[model samples]
Target: MEGLQLIATGGALPGRVVTNEDLSQLVDTSDEWITTRTGIRQRHFCAEGETAATLAVSAARQALERSGLQPEQIGCCVCATLSGAYATPSTACLVQKELGLAQDIPVLDVNAACSGFIYGAAVARGLLATRPQDDRRYALVIGCEQLSRLMDMTDRNTCVLFGDGAGAVLFEAVEGAEFAVDLGARGDMAIETPPCGPIRMDGRAVFRFAVDALPRTLHAVLDATHHTLDEVDWVVCHQANSRIIDHCVKKLEADSAKFYKNMDRHGNTSAASIPVALNELAETGRLQPGMRLACIGFGGGLTWGGMLITVKGSAV
Candidate 1:
């Protein structure tokens, strides 16, 4: 059997594109204000008929096709989101129905804000460890959000910073794979939950927390994996801002050309950022066989995580 594998990934967004200029017409913010502060020029928004689950299923379909897997082959479904339309009926269940997954397959939902993808991945990793050989064990891990649903569009501050989208990754149980995972949370840093609506961030505060926490998180994962920065081929971090990306690379002294980024095109997709970027990289043939990639993310709940994986032979 192969070791735990990120076989393939897929991402989907609403057809509607919301440019900063378009947002300016709705709110008091300017294109300059959004660009200067968040490094976001535009983002996608969900259409009238689209919901979080629908976008997630679209993403899952692409991933399943790329991976050559079927709905019944997946033993687990993990959905990561903070903006689901409902509070009950786990989003993963909704995905299971949409994907025609087996009734007995475990369905789980995780809410770690932007860090949700890493959290979902970690859960899928544990699932791989527990399943028996020849069990057809696989997990459909997704990070999705329709943040526009939570945005107080009347308030210019955060209205333009978020959009709606979904991204999915297929994790398969295999053998002979190298893996290192580290996850952390700071309760003191957490924003009050429930009724706070989705997320209301103090940009300055979150910036400080992220800059201080990410390096430590990365170092922890490196130490656990016994790998050095120079050994990494690609560093895929949450695409919140170009400034944050620049700061993290400088602090780690990572090679500029080796970093993978899509912020200029997608802005921030919240939980969907990393996997969306991963799919983009795979589609463009930027990530190849036998490469090592480090995935990191930080977000609300004041959480952060990092996962280091040695890319096995690629099928694409």
Candidate 2:
């Protein structure tokens, strides 16, 4: 299999910022109560006229600009989301139109919930492999979510845990770089959104699954790639909860500092969380060429996945 090289990354959050204090007005919760539990101080919520596709277009444009690749050079586009604007056109198609990408390329959306981004990456790698090598094929993978639309304002448990945003990355196929991925899902609704209703979850069950699944998935990917935790330059897990991340880090005996986090400000943007965190790291110059990164995601569909990738260039 041809390895995948991450060329550039970009992210976009909604303009409206909802702090814990703002949420407290809707729910009977205080800042200390929310922060101590979720490690989130504020989250972005979409206002009128802003949708997942719009946010994705914004992020994707930034990624394309940073990649120095024209929109026509993209051979495939994959979007990961659970809350998109339309159930028919697919958010990927909407993004393709918004970005003015070539019509010949494959464009589709994947719904693995929070694991959507990692799943989309795996799909892009497969799609890119099938393209002619001489064509200089590139894939655009995006994770976008309008999760606030699913929030129940009165239900603090689920309402305060989500936000709206999008994140994107450009990938090119290469040889010799190591790329290994693992994905799994249990056919149960431990966390889910009902038809025409807000999000619901068995918090205890979901928390237990995340802490156990995260480290196991990380180790599985590392074993497949023949690498160790110490060898990884950064570990970017889905920004769900700080406690979940802390537990997984402790279980693996990994350096907590190597784990990048931004949920304190962005909250949980569902599928967009990982890429959003990744873009932040890249923008701040924390990411560099040739570094090894382990990315993981877990959530709704009760899905979990991890990918081991080597940084391709200084662009991201």
Candidate 3:
């Protein structure tokens, strides 16, 4: 299969920044308590009139602009999220309309919970591989979440751990070295949501699952690619918890400096976490040409996956 290079990245967060102290007024929690447990001090929440689709569109536009690619040049649009404005039309469809992308192209959404971004990247790679070689096909992959809408403000356990945001990247098909990809689901509801109820989770179960699944997935991808930890420039895991990342780093016995994290400010944006972290790295000039990144995510649906990608400079 032809390799897909990440040519550009972008992210968008809601205007309202809610700190742990802010939640203290509504719920029985303190900044020190939340920070010690989740390593999250603040998070962004959507205000009136803001929706997942809107954030997705904003992030997508930034990515498109950064890539210098016209909207029509994109061959596919894939959005990863569990929260959408409506269940009928996928978030990708709404993004396509907002971005004025080609009408004939494939546009859809996927739900892998916190692992959704990595899942979306895998889907985009497969889609781009099928396109004609003569055409310069690109896939716009986005991870957007509106978790605040599902939050039970009174439930401190869940409410303090989530935020609203979206992140995006433009993947361009290129003839280059292929990278490894792996995806799996255990069909467990350690984390779940019902038809009308707010988000609920078994915190201990999730923490245990993440710590184990994350390093395993990272090593699986590295082994599949015949690479080693020393060769990877960055390890971007779902920014669900700082503790999970710390545990995975210790267990893997890998260089702690290689792991990237931003949960301290954005908290957990579910599907949006990894991409948001990627965007931050790119904006800060940390992502450079030829750098290898191992992206992993684990969450509800009990899904976990990882993909190895080589960073390519923005499209000319």
Roughly what TM-score does model 2 have, to 2 decimal places?
Answer: 0.98
Task: Provide TM-scores for the models.
Answer: 0.94, 0.98, 0.97
Write the residue-wise lDDT of candidate 1 on 1-316 in tens digits: 2445677888898888989999889888888988877778989888899988888889988888888877778988889888887777888888888788989767888988888999988888776666666565787899998887777778786677777889898876666677777788887544433543645667788788888777787788788778888888888888887788778789878787777777766777778888888888788887787778888889888889888876543523
The alpha-carbon lDDT assigned to residue 310 of candidate 1 equals: 63
Q: Candidate 2 — worst ten consecutive residues by lDDT sum?
A: 128-137
Candidate 3 local lDDT, 1-316, one digit each (tens):
6777889998999999999999999999999999999899999999998899999999999999999889889989999999887886999999999999989788999999999998998898888777666454899999999999888999988999999999998988777655778899999878997754599999999999998899889989999889999999999999998999999888988899999989999999999998899999999889989899999999999999899988888322
| 1-316 per-residue lDDT for model 2 (tens digits) | 6878788999999899999999999999989999999899999999999999999999999999999888889989999999997887999999899889989888999999999999999999898887776564789999999998887889999888899999998988777779899999998788878644599989899999999889999999999998889999999999999989998888888899999988989898989999998899899998899888899999988899999987787755
RMSD in Å for candidate 2, one decimal? 1.0
Predictions in order: lDDT: 0.80, 0.90, 0.90
lDDT accuracy of residue 108 in candidate 3 = 93
Query: Candidates sorted by TM-score, descending order?
Result: 2, 3, 1
Off by over 4 Å in 3: 134-136, 314-316
